[model samples]
Target: MEVDGNKFLNTGLLLVATILVAKLISAFIVPKSRKRLPPVVNGWPLIGGLPRFLKGPIFMLREEYPKLGSVFTVKLFHKNITFFIGPEVSAHFFKASESDLSQQEVYQFNVPTFGPGVVFDVDYSIRQEQFRFFTEALRVNKLKGYVNQMVVETEDYFSKWGSSGEVDLKYELEHLIILTASRCLLGREVRDKLFDDVSALFHDLDNGMLPISVLFPYLPIPAHKRRDKARQRLAEIFANIIASRKSANKSEDDMLQCFIDSKYKDGRPTTEAEVTGLLIAALFAGQHTSSITSTWTGAYLLCNKQYLSAVQEEQKNLMEKHGERVDHDILAEMDVLYRCIKEALRLHPPLIMLLRSSHSDFNVTTREGKEYDIPKGHIVATSPAFANRLPHIFKDPDRYDPDRFAVGREEDKVAGAFSYISFGGGRHGCLGEPFAYLQIKAIWTHLLRNFELELVSPFPEIDWNAMVVGVKGKVMVRYKRKELCVKQ
Candidate 1:
């Protein structure tokens, strides 16, 4: 067939032009269509990174951080847990609204422990109100009364210690913290009459949060069974206490009272169940964290003689100024001891990982300017244990240097808002932070002023196996009673 060469060439040129336009359009649209997920930790097919993560979460994160950068994901069986490792990329994780990053799904394991209609079991709005109850109960004014109880508990507990002896500081602090918590939070009734029973029940509840329980909370496990029984017994006990208080028309200066008196924004009174649940949640939140922090503080202080001496010097100066009285205001003045406790918490945050369930896709930009889009349905997490020790944010991150938080240094503030998130940060930041600090300070201050302490055992290792990571084994310390020289 005779063809016009000019016509055929023109047609071919037109086809090429159309193809090029399509290519150009694709170049712009394709990039926008594909979301860039954070680097994934390679694992076996199906099982994914569960084994390595189960082996050691912090260790796995440390190993992967250099290779994967700060933002990375580990697929655990069916779920994806994306970790935001440092403050540089953690602001969004801390600040995102509940709609974006929901805690309700990821922390359902806490439902059984905290009881129904509270915390992770409740919706975000209700949870916020419940949290407000905690906030009100732990306010500075409420903490003043709590601190007085803390002081009394500390003085009473330590007075039993011999003039000169060796003891497991860890055991002592754990026991003492529960006593203080019971007095200040669980009410004077539980503290005085039912201490041992309530304490054992709490132990059962805490032990129920195994790794498997996170995924299968209702599994037919012995620990879960014990936890359920303990929770029931606790409810009955508290219900009786609540009823007795109501019948007698009595009120007490304690967290139990605070929760009992707590009213919703609409003015509805809290139910017996709600009050009990709030109290359980409060004790659960503060008990382990405070004890673990207290133990770590003592361990670190004893290990670092210079810092220990600094705290001792601070205690001496305070005694001279305040004449042996240590209250909330006095504990607030304990900047040296506070720094030491804070440094320890930075190194060993009891709740290693803070988590949320991503309900919508979001993007995060790291300090290095690398950006990644996190897709929905992933468990978003930040490790305070890892983040608090980032070399870029904290100098000699491994070393127990309390002065890093001092006025002139303030390394924690060097990075940004979430740099020092041992107690977490932003909207979901720990409401119990001030209370935790004061409780630790009260214990340590009394010890510093009344006893000369020395580390007798080797430094304790991190008990990574613990649900609330803490010092492994006993923290043995030698102590001798010392007379305080208060100015007349």
Candidate 2:
């Protein structure tokens, strides 16, 4: 009887010891402050909930946010990732300076693609200046010239496909934008001489930017090797172009010219290497974003027949007033088309989530007066993908309704703040927004006036595995030359 009692006592003691050890480990992780820390569910002894979080961060976050409230910490192996949600939380997060929350730490994968001494690889001041060059190139007056290039390139692309044909816009739009971007941004030398080679190199760069690269950038993988090789090759090509421009003592009003004339704070002309890096950065920013947004816009508009009819009606009015000639001012008058694009962007933003690595201990107080501390070196995150779908911010969030953005409705403004962050908010917001809208508007307008398009299949499943999530597999569309079809 004494032996049985001793055995039960030992088991009870072991259980108590395990609980104390866990509490000790938790205490060791962070200080016990008066203010509460974000809720972190009990996970594995050493690794925590990393494996579960990594499986589907988007799905996991969505599930946890409701249970844990607006602010919570997700323990990833040894790292603590603090996710801030709600309108108030988003405003503070987006407006926070780079000093407090660094983007470079989370986006280190950009080092190989953008090369050294540029973008995420360099200081914020340097990157800020570099982005300014891009903004200058895409300025209002400069963009006026690009409209013609967009129209011309788009027209040329559709011209090759007879009176009727099926096009996988996944491939078709990618090629079209490459041509348009090359013509308008990369300059005449790229458009006329090095188009195919540059396209192939960019493909290699694209292949390297896989979702796995985000977490494991330095893996000894085939794609990473190809990505490095492609980066070197593109640098060589851009370097030669810059040299040739200087040797010829000539100039053109394009993005390349902006890079050539771009002067540093030190009064020295920008180097070929820096110019190359800047060009790659601009391309990286616009490449998938524009392509994916365009893809989504087409997929959604086609699926929603009533909206498609509305777009066609607007296009008819546009052509009546302006005739066949297209320009920036004329494209701006496309209110219906504009709202459609806006809705598409809201529903399917290119970057689902944005990350920041907290540099100092940051305190977050919710609107409800709940306080939490975000420890230094922890990752801070916000998701435009999820935010755009918030019921309070967007009415009937899942429904494809552009009328919500109409003058009287203006649902986006109802939230009165960073509610609609499809283009992001604050300083690091997408600089290419105007350019992207202009390009998309130009392409769609041209297609509307020229071709009769029909969706061949239902909307594609979102391919979350892609670095920038896009419609999975082929997005096929059938189009007939409108004028020819009318005559027939």
Candidate 3:
């Protein structure tokens, strides 16, 4: 019996060794593929191009695009990514269906931050229904109400400027947007009573949304642990709020109620866990984009005097027509300011790159009639950073000229579809675009009408460390109340 047992053990060990050797040999064997593929950006073995990609993905993409054409493959660690650059490729990317491309797979790393059973963590149909709640919450009628709150918050928050000395626009806008979003979306209980603690927790949560987290979400690290804790604490906080609301049988007209009242196709009520995840996702979507865009817009306007004068003139005209009463309609007429914001977004978009994981074999045809076959299980990335810089799409592509979007020179549309993708394009385009414009327009109109600001610091470079690219350090502006200054 002992001899038989030893023979069986030795046989099993030999079989495992044979399989391991076969797998190791296969790891280095490159598959022969049909159809043309863009050249893979080369790097050292095993790690491949991960170090370069981590250093500055935009820089690496730009360098590769010029050399490898619009479609190219690059390896990052064990992952193979095919980048589709320029507008034509962008059209194909944005229009691809869920079967061919899976956003959930690409963004599953966000599950920890967004909590469970919501958005990218769920099945596709469920996610669609979940996103419907967001759409309903952002509809015109709801926005009509949200705009009032937005204006009120903007006026109340800006009332404390006190003819400001030098203020860091980045720091101030981050706080301002969080307060406004919390008051409007998360319910008054959270905004009024739990603001500080919630905001602090949100900070820790935001810190955990880095690129490294996207790669290894479950790695035992301090920030990842803090992120998990913050997510749980936020869930507890929202659960308490929901319990109290149900106990009182009270309903409030805000996103929290909308989420609570939302249902699946089968009529199942949304869970409290889902509600908390929705709020975190909503804030996550709008917070960084709004805050960063506001800072960039402020910095750009301050640095360009001609555009500043033009926007200020438009604001003065609005004031002459509407006085201190700022509303949605008045905000709409500030077209010059709108163009300036649009231009700033083109230059420094909040989310620099959008990624999708390919689920099946797909073909991409370039303008030259060349077809590249993308294989299954490869990650695909589309960068606004590169798309916006396509020379033929925008004349003097690198210059900051807002007029490029004006009148006969509507450059965003000049190069065909997906040319200007600051807000993204196609089925997955931004739903909060109107709200973003309204909030930003309200704040800037008020600032332009109330204060004169000067750029007190040199234009800061991009802080590549942030998940969203933000201006480095302080973009300081020296300010004095316009009402206090005598007319020239």
Show the colliding residue pairs in model 3.
none
Q: TM-score for every candidate vs. truth?
A: 0.92, 0.92, 0.92
Ranking by lDDT: 1, 3, 2
How does each model score on lDDT? 0.89, 0.84, 0.85
lDDT of 3 by residue, 388-480 (tens): 888878899888899999989899887888988888888788888888888788778767877889989899678888888878898888988
Name the better of 2 and 3 by lDDT.
Answer: 3
For this target, which candidate reaches the highest lDDT against the unseen true structure?
1
Candidate 2 wrongly placed segments (more than 4 Å): 1-31, 484-488
Q: Candidate 2, residues 1-488: lDDT per residue as tens digits?
A: 99999999999999999999989987997567665678985568778877766676678777887788778888777788888876867666788899998888899988888888888888899888887888888899989998888888888777788878898988888888888888888888999899999989988988998777878887879999999999999899988888888999989867889988988777878888888888887887887888888888898888989998999999878777777778889888989999999999998898888889889887888767888877888898888888888787788999999999999999888877788888888877888899999999988887777788888977788887777877799999998887732110
Question: Where is model 3 more than 4 Å wrong at Cα?
Answer: 1-31, 484-488
Give me the overall lDDT of model 2.
0.84
RMSD of 3: 4.0
